[model samples]
Target: MKQFFLTLAGVFAGLVLFVIVTPIALIALAAAGSSAPATSPNTVLELDLREGLTDQPPTNPFAAFGGAELSVIEVVDALDRAGDDRNVKAVLIRLPEMGMTPAAADEVRQAVRRFRASGKPVIAHSQGFLPVGAVMSSYMVGASASELWMQNTSSFQATGFAADEVFLGDAFGRYGVTADFEQRYEYKNAVNTFTESDFTPAHREAMLSWMRSIYDSALANAAADRRQTPAAMRQAIESGPHSAEQAMALKLVDKIGQVEEAEAEAKRRAGRNAQLVSVADYVSNHGLQPGSGSDAIAIVNAEGAIVTGRDAGGGFGSGSTIYSDDTAAAIYEAIENRAVKAIVIRVSSPGGSPDASEQILAAVRAAKAAGKPVVVSMGTYAASGGYWISSEASAIVAQPSTLTGSIGVFGGKFVLTEALGRFGVDLRGLSVGGEYADAFSPTGRFEGQDRAAFAASIDRTYDQFIARVATGRRLPEARVREIARGRVWTGAQARELGLVDELGGLHEAIARAKALAEIPADRSVRLIRYPTQKSPFEALSEAFGVSAEGAQALVAVGGVLASPEAQGVIARARTEQLRARGASVLADQPVR
Candidate 1:
């Protein structure tokens, strides 16, 4: 027994040593081998959207290790800087195939337009715009460029966005699984997936309303960028998938050729011997220095599903989760920071725990009380609990295509009594408390007092939600209730309904924050990340500080860092990260 203990201790010590030493070695090598090239005259900054864009730098250090992914903010800042850079003669972008979230695409398109206004031509090249989903969003950004290039024989099938919801009510019934869910109102359709096979009238109405709004925004923006009338552009896009040649013929694309030819064209347009540099690399080495000014706008990112407690360290099956504790801490830090003039909380969630949402909202209120105006910047979508946290912000800004406002509550669980009984497994409960003690038991369904209690809890949550929205938006309680039946709304719709203050992206949100704080428009203000983003090494140290599992994860990370497959892992991890940020099963459809 003593020998076994000694061996186990020795193994743990060895693992700790390996985890610490291997990463340091890998970091040193990565630094030495990947030195960014010096920015020189006549350089063409290459922005590759082929991998898509993340809203922000990754929060997890382990995930951060595998890739050098640049966020939308990073790209926007880099392009803006490059526009004034004498060294950067032009810009080139490789469009994504899978497409980007409408909000992210809009932000990049705005940046591209700004870059073009500097008299430096921006060229966009696309292999194809496959019609998987949100492909038109990819085309929207491409259309904003000085030249749109497509690969030979590639299809341009960026038709429109469509989401398919999976209804498991029938399946559950057949399998003897009872989905016992209750919602505050009919339009809170998240529970409908388990309760009904088809869309209810309210669900259909809400879905079409937001979908059409987003589609119109995409079409109008694309048409304006392509220099065509909205009617003509709508007719062209609605007319099935067009070939690259057909797109060129219809003036939907500027040029058609292989990727190499497109590159040559970009080089030609850039004058002579213009070197192509990765925008990610350029930004890492020379992007706008954050926190460079005396006065700062602290950005607290509340991304993923709103939940209680601290981050779970992103273990297996752990998608993006915004812990209330972490989010509140970030907001409180900003409130206490003397240099912070205002706070901008970037939210991209579809809702989660109501209690968690309230916790975060309290922090936002605390910031306001401290004289630091709090502005909300909605990304992709921020519905239900997402909106709950945002309701009291000093100002709310969202992209036209962003989905927000699902002011409702729903809660319940799957009753597996019959299913388990059929399998000869009984999940019986032995309770010594009141009758409602078995209310949440998997083997029992809510009945009598338990049912009444559950219904009351749900109603309380709903009432609180509507009251908060009414108070925050300064609307009447009746007016809030009329619009609140848990229906999701597009940012454009929300703006019209007075749910959101403005329709814009993070850039505009920052501007709003500046105005509220009385900062001059012309003066540059330092942007500080709330919760204080740590260096990769610092995060790694914290990760390893936790447990043996963290050590094992670090070891796996070391293997990845040392291997050539690190790039591929980075791409996959980034996709997962984006999904966690944008995909929610609560209120809005998945963005991209």
Candidate 2:
């Protein structure tokens, strides 16, 4: 019996070792075999926008396993390089069915325009366009190309923007649940989703403000590309969904055919024997690091909800979530690096924890004290806590459609006493010392002195937020207060209101950083990204403790659970979990 048990233990140990080593070996072999291919003469660069883009590169390599993943920076840099490459002739882009965010579309469209300026043709092909999301943004990008093509059967659904939200107040009331929340002012409507049945007056006004700004900007840009007046473009697009043939008649699209025909046209433009090379492949072959020099501009990415403590690292079936400690540490590291001349922090968040925002804001101040000028580049949305950390930057740059400036705070919790009673699940509470010790108890209501105390704390936080913005932007306290009232603004409106310094994207931010650091415009400076990405091998080693149980967990995580569909579900779940935890300074604006 003792021998049998020992043999079983040995077999289990071997199985664990095999399970661990096999994947590592296979991945290593795959990496070894996948050498970068050389670019041939007269190659046409093909870029597919169907794969969504993020602000920063994936934290782990395994993220590239299922499909090609590209960041906005990567796509822009690749096009910039390809424009100058003599071997590259033309570019082909495949548009998505749904659409992209307004900011992302603007950035890529600018790059496309720059590429077209080099006298090379850019052909954009769309399989179809849906009215589900920001379809107009996608059309704006396609219009930037030298020629736009749509599938024969595809419909052009570039209608105006509209926002729809589902409020849970009535449902919760029917179920005997209570949602108690407080805001510093009237404009902070995030809590309204839970406490009210529909959009409040302030909410409707704020939504319309940003949506109108985006609509106008998109029309103007697309009109410039198509050589038509903004009013004419708007009239044509707003005139209901157009069929492919109808779009051609209206001059909305230059050509109509299948995607394959579009590809053939691009290749024909590239001359005979021209190969269609993927943008990813081209980038991999010829590395396109922005610059290289002794002096460097550090890029710290703060994308996702800002919570306290170290980052969860977003490994295996997870998405990006910003952690305060990690972000602050990255800024500190940039400040400490002697070679670092300036810092450009890319921010893409709707805000998170108040404490975390304060911590990161302090780091930004410290970097300035160390003589490293900091420039903020706002992504899709940077409101509430996101704006908090960016308030003191040397300069702030944002896209015309970027949502920002929700300068307010809120705090409260739900009372589940009635809800639990309905389910016959009573939650009893016990107190130890202070009378208000159980005030935060989930089963009870927040009232009396305790509620007042909580409200006071929120008021103090809001005051601090306004003060920070006033000092950073060099505006009067009265002016800041007028804009504070928890209001949100688009980047264009924020610029006019003296909230944001410039209206542009990452490229503009980097240029401003160079000017502030006294670096010459003609000189090249290396870009060093902070909170550096980890290798898959390193991530795996840390994730799995090399034990049998860890190996088992790895297998379970990597199997059907790692599929693209499954990972998306897991990512949404993780986002909701993080959102709930970081609601203190949150100004969440759901993508339309």
Candidate 3:
């Protein structure tokens, strides 16, 4: 019997060995076989602006998975490198379905113009032309293109800007649901969508004015770049959508052709035979090697809600949360690295955990203590915990329409006892521990001292938040509270409130950081991005199998649960839950 068992065990071990070693051996053979020059060697980097340029949580999965999105710095750096690279002859700018913010569009336009000045031509292509947003059909930026091509069958759709608001008041009324929220700012219209059928006059007026400013700037830039008058571009925009031939006649596009034809034209202009390469591929090939140099500004981005602790699944699964530990560690590494001279905190979050916020804030402080200037650039929405980290920065820059500042906190328990009772299930417990032991359980209402204790803790955290902001912004505690109370504000309003120092975009933030660091404007400053690091082996493993790193995250979370830090973890989790629930109540404007 023992001999039979040993034979079975030996067979199982052999199977396991084959399972592990077969793939690696195959990969090695494949790698060896493909060790040749790239087939499409001479490349024309294509920057296809299909989605909205955002620093916020990506609304679309394509942007995250397809890797088609670019941050402001990423776009600029690509342009700079492409312009200088002899192998990269020209650029194909495809704005087939762009939905970028005005500021981001402007940055790209500026970069395009700079690239063109290098004597490298840029060819713009679109499937169907559209002027739906300032970024989509900015005449000012379009003007910079050496040639604009639209599909032969395509037509331009130039609908003027409109901010549509969706209200749920009637829906809630039918369900007997009520929304109770407290906010300090008159412009905090987040709750309006829940309470009103349409925008209030104030909201409409504010939104329109902001839109107009952005559109006008875009039009002016496009006109200047395209060598057309603003009046002419405005006339074309007002003429509505046009067929390909009509667009060419109206000087809206240079020609009518397919994407391949446009690429060919670009190649011809570059005076070289080149293959078109995606921007990501080009960056992968030519961008700075990670951790290679000392004079670099690492951009550490935390684009979504900052939850506490670790998140399994790389924070990519649907409804999965952002892990503050991962983000903070990224920042910490950048700060500790002598290779990174400065840090850019690009935030697009609607806030999350107070504990996580403090964790990040401490890291930012540590970065400063290391003599690294940390500059913050706000994206679409950076409120609450987002603002918490930014308040510690040496300088903060935001676009005029950027939503920021929700200086408040709330916490509550979710009671499911009645629902369970209805289902004929009951939970009874006897505990010898403290009252707070069951503070977070979903089955019971937090009553008596438990409720009071939670509230007191929240208040203490709030006080700390205010104090931190006061120190960061150089404002008194009382004055900060005046604008606190979970109020949200637009970038312009934030600037007026002294919450942000300037009204600008990412480039401006970088410039400010460079100036603070005493680097000359003309001198080159290399940017270094943090976290987003992976070895070729790791990448291959991810492409083929479940990542060991993911397993490690689960183990780490389990360890946290088993340790003394469990209380802090639980508190942070509760804070994140509140923030997630309160997000809709704290937006300065309605999400589209």
Candidate 4:
């Protein structure tokens, strides 16, 4: 009786604590809202494009906890607004500090160019230690800047472009894991990393040509912007990276200075001494008013794989993975929101389950049925099911290097008959009613009938995939099949093949989406993210050990509780497996 009373007391204590903390948390959040900066005297918005460009807005839980990490779209929107704000003196292009992808960097570059065009002087500065791509992109935008500065102590690390692939064939062999995979063409090197020691001749040739084309184009653009010959830039990169002093001597940088010195130069050019504001602060201050209030555009970011359920910290954060259900629901909600004028579906997935892909595609169709334009912006890898969901978009945009159009489905079970035999395990089972009763057992390989059924299912899925593509792209069915033979293509190739309508990045896709939605180019649009907000307490409970009791209970009930930590480990492992399978649609290399 005393022990029962103690248990009851513990439950009561927990309930009381929850009630007390909930109101305090809400009050604290309310107080946080009041701390927004009223105004700034001198604001030079700094745009950092470090983590390759993303089509979807990032969710930063840390930001909710008081750190500031701007979403990609948020940064772009702020820069656009800052160009017209009278209090905003100048803008700074800080790409070197943030290693951004060519596409993402291009978005910022375009924004900076627009800001400069608005008669606001833009200053571009870099700390010399930057990747070749970042340096080249920054140079392109800094060309339009009133001044370009590099840190005195910094030096360039402009190693000419190279793409590296790690092969695990030998390791797999050592582990007795056979990677029996099939592909339709030599250019399909998706499975090569796991099956071969190095790139096949065809793979090497294609990748080399693609890289050369991208690097050459980038160099040409940078040369034109910085007023340096491509040949000179090529020579400098081939020889060695240059110090900031050497770069200035070579006319690569306008001046040698630190961030503060660059800020002073920006102030002098703007002819105003004003307080400097970050891109995040500037946007918050401007509020969510539209540019002209005529019409609005909605940006719906679909980053990561399309999964079937919700999993926090598993979308785009560090150690993140895909949650298909969460993604599908988010897309569905975005489609139903009345305030969302048009939908821009930004995809960066490899592919995953057919069910999850269909779920997301259904939402896409619903969005289109509502007379809202849906435009797809493809990121680095949007092949397989990534291509599946994108087929319904009114317009599709891809970058030159975007890897897309892997139109195939593969499914099989790994039979561990030999491994189990080695364990001295003799398994016997009673006959089930159906012939396919043992279909999922690991003890045996799939027989002729099972294989035939599986093949038929795959064929049906492939046909549906082809039909979807044909209808969505407005292409003939035969033509779709011609391009859908499990082959991958660069964005440029896909555009020529009609898989993509245009060759551009996310910003261009957004522009096209707005045009399709009949929104004037000058009108304001705010991106509304789906997935209802979770309170800080809920977030914290999820982060710690507070909310995982159900998972623990499930594992224990299943008699799989080898240890206290086993439940979490198993949950993570299963989550990763789902992510790997689903993310295959957008990923270039398999998930590591």
Question: Which numbered prediction scores highest in lDDT against the true structure?
Answer: 2
lDDT of 4 by residue, 1-592 (tens): 5544554465354333334333444444454355555556566666654433444444433332332255455666677777777777788776454234545445555566677778887778787645543345445556556677888898866545655788987776665445544444456577777779888887787677556655665677666667678898677655657888877777767888888888777766655566666665565555433444535555555666666766754121333234667766666676667777787777777777667788788888887898888888887568888899899889999876566888877655544555455577665555677767776566565677866666677778888888899999999999988767777676767888888998776668878988998877877666554554444444435544455454234323334333446545644554465454443223323212
Candidate 2, residues 1-592: lDDT per residue as tens digits?
Answer: 5544554465455434344444653474365457755568888999998988876665665655534477777788889888888888999999988868888888899889989999999999997778867788899999999999999988988878877888999998988778887797899988888899989999999888888998899889999999999988998999969899988888889999988998999999999999999887776565446588878999998888889999544245336677899999999999999999999999999999989999999999999999999999998889999999999999999999888999999878888888889999998899999877887788877889988887888889999999999989999988998988888998999999998999888888999999999999888899888877664445555444454446445554555553557656654554465455552324333211
Question: What's the distance in Å from true for residue 447, model 4?
Answer: 5.4
Residue 355, candidate 3: how far off, in angstroms? 2.6
lDDT of 1 by residue, 1-592 (tens): 5544554465455444454556654563465347555687788889988766667655653443454376777788898788888889889899988668888888888889889999999889999888876777888999999999999889989778787789998998998999998897888999999988999899999998887887888899999999899999988888869999998988889999887887787788877887888887787666445746689999887778888999745221214568999999999988888999999999989899999999999998899999999999998789999999999999999988888998999999889989988899888878886888778988867888888999999999999999889888899999999998999998999999999998877789999999999999888899888666544444545544545456446655666655545545543554454455553223322211
**Candidates by lDDT, descending order:** 2, 1, 3, 4
TM-score of each prediction: 0.87, 0.87, 0.70, 0.75
lDDT against the true structure, per candidate, is 0.82, 0.83, 0.67, 0.65
Residue range 1-592, candidate 3, lDDT tens digits: 5544554465354333234333443443354345433425456788877753444323222234444355555676678767777777788987745346655665567678779898878888877745555434344455578888888998777545555678976665555444433333344566666666777775676566556756665666667777789899888867877888998898878888999899888777655566878775565444432323336777776777788986443222223234688778888899887767788888878888888888889998998998999999887667888999899899898876576887877655434555556567785666668878877776666678986787688778788888999999999999998887666676777888899998776667878887888777776767766556443234333433546565334334444444445645544554454455442223222111
Number of backbone collisions per candidate, in order?
0, 0, 10, 28
